[model samples]
Target: MTDALAIATDLMPVLARHAAAADAGAAFPHDSVRALREAGLFGLLVPAEYGGMDGDLADLVDVAAVLAGGCLSTAMIWAMHCQQVDAVVRHAGERLRSDLLPRIAQEGYYLASVTTEPSKGGHLLTASSALLPEDDDLLVRRDAPIVTGGEHADGFLITMRAGPDAAPSDVSLVHLHRDQVEAQVVRDWNAMGMRGTRSVGMTLSGVAASHQVIGQPGGFRAIAVDSMIPAGHLAWSACWLGTARGALDAVVALIRSRHVPSSMSRDSELLRQRLARARIDIELAGGYLALVRDEVLRRRHSGQPLDDRSLQIRIDTVKVACSELTFSAVDRLVQLGGAMIGYQRDAAVPLERHFRDLRSASLNYSNDRLVGAIGTMTLLDGAGRLP
Candidate 1:
């Protein structure tokens, strides 16, 4: 077993115990974060030389799924952190790597991404921030629309235009420490789901050295297409599946304990059917997830990034299917569970919380937008024979 999976397994029970409280209070899962940091989970994607696990895609998926089964918020935080970690590991310069990766692995420094901007109008590709020449360093000024766990993150991968004269595509991903960037929480994170993510809007202004930006100018587009989409899509899908599995586990336990046959109202054979459907849905989703995961690992081992449109389409399909199927499983399990599933006070069931968290999957990037993108791709390319 990978260190990520092993450590995550040990953290699951503790995370589950506090998940309800985290949701109820709409607070960051600080305790869970602490445990993860201590376990070196924050550096799961960093290299072994940097004191990391040097874990593969399967390891990332396994750890994410396991954490999601216990707490969606914590799982998401981990996923976001891993995404940034991937960027740093794959694109960052030697100086930045030497300065940051080791500390991230040993000091428990959490990282978050700052890609979306208020002025960009929700298009993640466009950067609203301008990088200005200030002697040896650059001055970054812009407001990010949302920064999940921003308050707690030690730093952020701030996406911005390379310079004032740069084109829209000439963007850079800069890593700025908290002391360097001023994060003003512009909007409170009182959302209907994923409350523990603490995804608040923040106005940012910072200064970064030239080396802080990963890769060369205009390289962010490549990074987004190659690393960001695949990692984010796969990890998020696995986490969603984990949440569904947790709900299904609760439903199964409840049914096994009280599902008596005969004239009992809740003991219909249809109840078993509902449970079976939930299981099958999760299984089907898991199978697809595993297939795609294997492909991701294969390509990684081959030193080829998943940059092709066909692979991207496949990744999007996996994300959409896993999101829908997990939501379906949780919804079905809740319906079969009846009134007890609605109990707000019980942390053991977590049915209602699961429902709320699962709802965000479709809205994460809008399944509608992906469907449109896919349809346009199919129309243009003919969807003819993918390897």
Candidate 2:
């Protein structure tokens, strides 16, 4: 096995053991995070100069999928954290990079994304709150309706309007340490799935140092389009794929343990068919993911702008396809498991948790809207062609 894959396989059992308790109690997987920290997974995106693994998209896909197979919440948290790292590496000022990168690499500090505001109505690109200049510092006082991992992160990448009078679309990204920001849990996190994410709404207000702003004014749009969207889409797709795999693995184990003799029953035949279908769906989605991964990395390395509207449309397609296919695979697994899949407390089968988690996949920023976005891009960009 490849070294990265081997590392992921070694960590899966540990993460799987804690997945049940974490889901049941809606608790963060502290142990899982610690394990990942020790494994250098937290530094998977940081450059080697900062003592990180210097890993690429393919590495990220494999690692994220492996972790998601064991625990979706942990995998998601990890993915978002990596996104934050990507932002800092790509755009942060030299002083901030020198100060924070090593800490992230050596200290394993998680960085959270704080961009979704209540007033934005699910549009993460716009920020209602503005960054007010206070003497030498920037004051960012705004209520983020949803800040995933806000309560647990060591720092945050906050988005805000360029100024109090700036348009909502004129947004910028800022880095703030935990001490600089006060995040109150305004909305309780009692979600149907991904409960372990503890993705609660927060009233966030912070003062960032002059050097903390990652890029130029109104630069968040470029970063979001180029780096954040691609990385997040790939990582999320990997996680969903892993979640489906985990569910399938559970069903396969159950089938093996059943020990049915001689001739196979009708139920067994149907189960086999479903299993084959699910596997095929996963493989197809994975093929697309690989294509997207290579294309994105090549574009990035070649200094080609990923700002093309068609490229974004293609990304949306990849994301929606992967998420839907993964959900389909998991649903088939649940059907194959019969009544036993509903037993939430059954330690032998964690299909309920996987089901709950995968249900949130399509709900992430609404797949329907994303498909509509692709259509809009295709129409407006001449012949509605996609990259």
Top candidate, metric lDDT: 1
lDDT string, candidate 1, 108-197, tens digits: 788998887766654556675679989999998878777899989999998898899988768888889999988799888988889899
How many clashes does each candidate structure show, in the order listed?
Answer: 0, 1
Q: After superposition, how far is residue 202 of candidate 1 from its true place, in Å?
A: 0.7
Lowest lDDT 10-mer window, candidate 2?
Answer: 258-267
Q: Per-residue lDDT tens digits of candidate 2, residues 331-383?
A: 77666666655344473567777878889988887788888888888787765
Local distance difference test scores for all models: 0.84, 0.83
Task: Report the CA-based lDDT of candidate 2 relative to the real structure.
Answer: 0.83
